[model samples]
Target: MSETETCDLFVIGGGINGAGIARDAAGRGLKVVLCEKGDLAEGTSSRSGKLVHGGLRYLEYYEFRLVREALIEREVLLKSAPHIIWPMRFVLPHSPSDRPAWLVRLGLFLYDHLGGRRKLPGTRTLNLLRDPEGTPILDQYTRGFEYSDCWVDDARLVALNAVGAAEKGATVLTRSPAVSARRENGLWTITTRNSITGETRSFRAKCIANCAGPWVSDIINRVAGSNSSRNVRLVKGSHIIVPKFWAGSNAYLVQNTDKRVIFINPYEGDKALIGTTDIPWEGRAEDVAAEEKEIDYLLAAVNRYFKEKLRRSDVITSFSGVRPLFDDGKGNPSAVTRDYVFDLDETGGAPLLNVFGGKITTFRELAERGMQRLAHVFPNMGGNWTEHATLPGGEIPNADYESFANTLRDAYPWASRKLVHHYGRLYGARTKDVIGAAKSLADLGRHFGGNLYEAEVRYLVAREWALEANDILYRRTKHYLHLTDAEREAFADWFAGERLAA
Candidate 1:
């Protein structure tokens, strides 16, 4: 028989929302068990457009409340995780054929003032022909607007939240699926089976939070045998990665003929990430992939604004994710609400909180509110505290990453600047913990190409719940993007050997 544990909260997902909720609940003195069937953020959470901004276009749909909350949360998130989230300037080259200049200006104005703007710079008008940001843009776009937002390593954000939850006395079970959940004796009995180790564990939880994202409905019906009146509308969004053609550090936001806006952002060290088409999807989330037409559509959108045209051959890679939006009877997938909905099913005294329709930008706020909804059920849980708290590795003094980067370089003067910068951005104050007492590059152990070393890999496996090579290469870090084909294969082979030996 598998060992059974008692917990105050049982969260049935490991995506951003579920991880965030687990962290918040644990911080409030609740014993939480967060279970995931795969690596953290291996699904939709890692495949975001990588921005922590108030959805600028959501304003066009008159979603003022949603926009305002996201804007406010943007500031809070930036303050919380400056290491992985920082201010980014987006240049929107005005195309009179798409949206009028006045309308764009109006939206920018509201975006600046909608939430209490702090730390981040406000919007500004620009002469596209004169500004450095306009150099790569076509001459036809004479005027433009530059606005502020923040970029995030989406996968790392989810991991840090899970780490925070664990630090606060929460059990984070990765690759463990909740196979059975039933309401019994005013409590919930949840059983989880480890897919990798063939180990089974059960928990007696007072409440359950169904933050299963796209699988939210499935968990309610299949696992818990509980039904929800709410449903998720799966919207597929795709992105393509290409070699960075532009010279500036800034990102671009352009309008397509279909009235949808596409973002072309500077990604990694030398890549540009262009994305996202909102198409209604009736397929499984795991089966989502970027179609050929979607790639061409993104390239065509970019060609419309830039002087240098992109070819389909220039696309290095493409990925797709399903946005589990709440069904609001809206026919247009783009018009679906980015806001979240919570259905608290308090049947038979054991409550089930089902979350639906939330974006990465508003996850913290969503988690905070979801916990507040169960305040009566947990009459003694702590009050809201994540609002101003720093995430793991984000404890830099004053949340200043650049200053911390310089300080880190000084600390490890023997390390290359690129290595220092990589660790600084990814791990921040925790870089020392990853590197240990290593004095030089040679002391860092086997180098599997790029800045990846044995030290960091060991730390991730030991502390960050990294299990397989994909979890380390794809989700926890982006080492696969920089490593060559042969190098990646060799690393994977070596990782398998190491796991078997362990």
Candidate 2:
């Protein structure tokens, strides 16, 4: 709280990697400061495919190490954040032209045995012609495989890590950007400017971490005035949201003729989330969106398999994100490795850790190993402990979400079943904090269509660093998917007026 403050670690970028490192470092008894350019997870973190999965297709590229590490992380992350993450079965309808049945079985076998899987169910053969999951599919696809993967509330996962870091004594600053940093006299002098107030602040950090995702290289060259031999490939991926068509809880995985796979997963209770095309992108990461051609391609892929034909009009909303993949010199964008690399510059006595490429599943191990790279500097820092820790609101008995849901119903018996579900799934053990002492529908305040209530919005603003209306409607919660356009406009107007009066 001065012109210049000093800390053990200073982290730039408030995405999952940055927040995760901050939490891990702080919990290890190290002083930490984390700053973000925008709201937490406002970047690619919130706009991801939202699956905590091991890249099943990576087997073709011989990335067994990455797949194994990711597979192991699935159960660890699920236990750590049970409320926001849970297992979902994916039904991959077999396509003979794309891959042989024996090859598929071999991949599935490796997926089952390669990792330390304890909780998630293994892959099973499905009869597409006889099973209800296949009722919507064409008769040609008679045999399929159903496998397990975890779904995550990607945006909330970032927020929870930030909150956990703050609780562990880290200075968490939202709407703050690290404009510049320089190493001098074995310390980093970093300047951060608050975007909201236009106020500049400076700090002295023992070490600095660059987790800027798509902006990783810019941070190295422009902010730190340093260079890394490693580079990040900005491949863009896009997803679209449509009304839920099928009856089961299982998600569908379709193999396109292009040999790329697309996921159609259940989203926000009543909708289906479909996605993803890997196209080489030259545009700015922030400007990426679902192009018209990508949308048609996705629709066509789904239309080829399911009885429920989707049109362009059926797509309610779509988003895109640029993956900061480490350049492996592969010609194909999809063939690029999802593995991560770290560069430590300790030449000036002050260390600068540059995180190159990483996925959500591997962030924990990445942080642990990253800290190990700097062990020579801080010999007294604690050992790795995040493998057994619970994230905020993830303290359920044995990470049992269903048992916890039942308990939530017992506690909030007066609340509607749907309302209880919204709170339970989002807040978990912390549901009481959102519900407070409300005992009836009147205490929930105004209803803004669907389950978007004034109480939940207020909770997010007061506790979760929610500033803009879109922060509450889109990122922190998926209320936009269920609300009409008129309702969303009204909510935005109301939010604007409230902020002005404040």
- Which model scores highest in TM-score? 1
Tens digits of per-residue lDDT, candidate 1, 390-469, equal: 99999999998999999999999999999998898888889999999999899899999998999999999998999999
Off by over 4 Å in 2: none
Q: Per-residue alpha-carbon lDDT of model 2 for 137-231, expressed as tens digits?
A: 98999999999999999999999998888889999888988999998999999999989888888899999988999999999999999899898
What value of lDDT does candidate 1 attain over all alpha carbons? 0.95
TM-score each candidate. Answer: 0.99, 0.98
Which 10-residue span in candidate 2 carries the lowest summed lDDT? 1-10
User: Which pairs of residues clash in candidate 1, taking residues 3 or more apart in a chain or in different chains?
Assistant: none
